[model samples]
Target: MTSHVFRVGNGHDSHRLADGGPLVLGGISVPHNRHSVGHSDADVLLHAITDAILGAAAEGDIGEWFPDTAEVNRGRCSSEMLLEVWTTIQQHGYSIVNLDCTVFAQRPKLGSHKLKIRQHIAELLKIEITQIGLKAKTGEHVGPIGHEEAIAAHCAVLLQRTDSLV
Candidate 1:
């Protein structure tokens, strides 16, 4: 008999907003008055996705793979980070089943740019757009996100073993 296994992981990331006018999210730059502050591109959505994939494979989080303290990682692109994580897990015989993601920000309505962001993320993961779910929310004036002081993202991923060892 052949056995199959599934793994699920959830990840969250948040970054403080700054004076920058353009915000990068899910590999797409969206027009906004504030941007996320971080060592890298600070794409909260992509960071969360990377963590979810790594977590699902029992691998360490992004901090372990790409430490923010490293000068080499400064200004690094989040899409590239996500791609590298995906490659590592693929070599371990794991494939993404699906990913559901949410981004929280108070400004720059995401409805119009969601499809573009979803498509960009799908390309990074090498998965069909249909396999990814993207949602945007506001903090409802309750927290940093609501106050437009920060942005946050959450991601959940499902992965399955692709290689069967007989």
Candidate 2:
């Protein structure tokens, strides 16, 4: 009989905003004049989720797995990266119990897009939508995020061991 052990991990990511039309977040494309700038698609939400899962599993961070120095990572899709991380964690006998995420932006209010974002993330993780909780925030005209120069995201995940403990 194995006892279940729970692990909690937290991750955060931020990226500068560049003039663009579509901004990707949590695997969903949102209509926006500015988009995140990074080596990949720069989906801040997905990147944070990936890091959270990896941290819970004691795996190295996303940078170790996908480095900007590698040309192969350029323009890569963030959803694919998140899916790979989820698959790896599942193989290690870890199952996600829940995830709480937050995104901060100064423009293009996200209230209308929250549900879609959650759905896309759930689909990518192959988990029920209820397991994911997402929130959107504004920078309140303070920092880079408030100035509309950047977008940021944070994620906290709870994982449970599914394998038997000897």
Candidate 3:
């Protein structure tokens, strides 16, 4: 068995909001008047989750793997990026134990969409929906998040080593 049986990682991401519709979060499109601005599709939730997985595996960050400077990364789908990361970690013999995620947004309440988000993430990770925990919070009109100028997300993941190696 591996020297370490478990590992934990945390990740965060944020993006400025621009006037638009169909805000994408966790691979699901939500009805909103604003969308996140970034080189990719800018799904903050997925980005954070992808980072958490990479961190847990002691792998490089998402930016290192998918640099914004590359034209191929422009408008790339966040879900596809995440899947690639997931596949890499699995190849390294890491399996997810559980994941907890939080999203901060001032507009468009996310209570109704939480289930779908969890389900989608579970599908991507090939884990049970029960293994994922998700929460939504508002900035209460205080800062960039509260002012609806940006959206942010955080994710924490527990991973287990599945291979026999040091």
Show pairs that collide, candidate 1.
none
Ranking by lDDT: 3, 2, 1
Question: What digit string (tens of lDDT, one per residue) describes model 3 on residues 19-103?
Answer: 9888999999999999999999999999999999988888989999999999999999999999999998898888888999999
Where does candidate 3 have its weakest 10-residue lDDT segment? 157-166
lDDT of 2 by residue, 1-166 (tens): 1254988999999999999779988888899999899999999999999999998888989999999999999999999988888898898898889999999999879999999999898888888999999999999999999999999999999998876434
Q: Judged by lDDT, which candidate is best? A: 3
Query: Which has the greatest TM-score?
Result: 3
lDDT of 2: 0.91
> Candidates' TM-scores?
0.95, 0.95, 0.96
What's the lDDT for all of these models?
A: 0.90, 0.91, 0.93
Identify the runs in model 2 with alpha carbons over 4 angstroms from their true place: 1-4, 164-166
Candidate 2 weakest ten by summed lDDT: 1-10
lDDT score, candidate 3 = 0.93
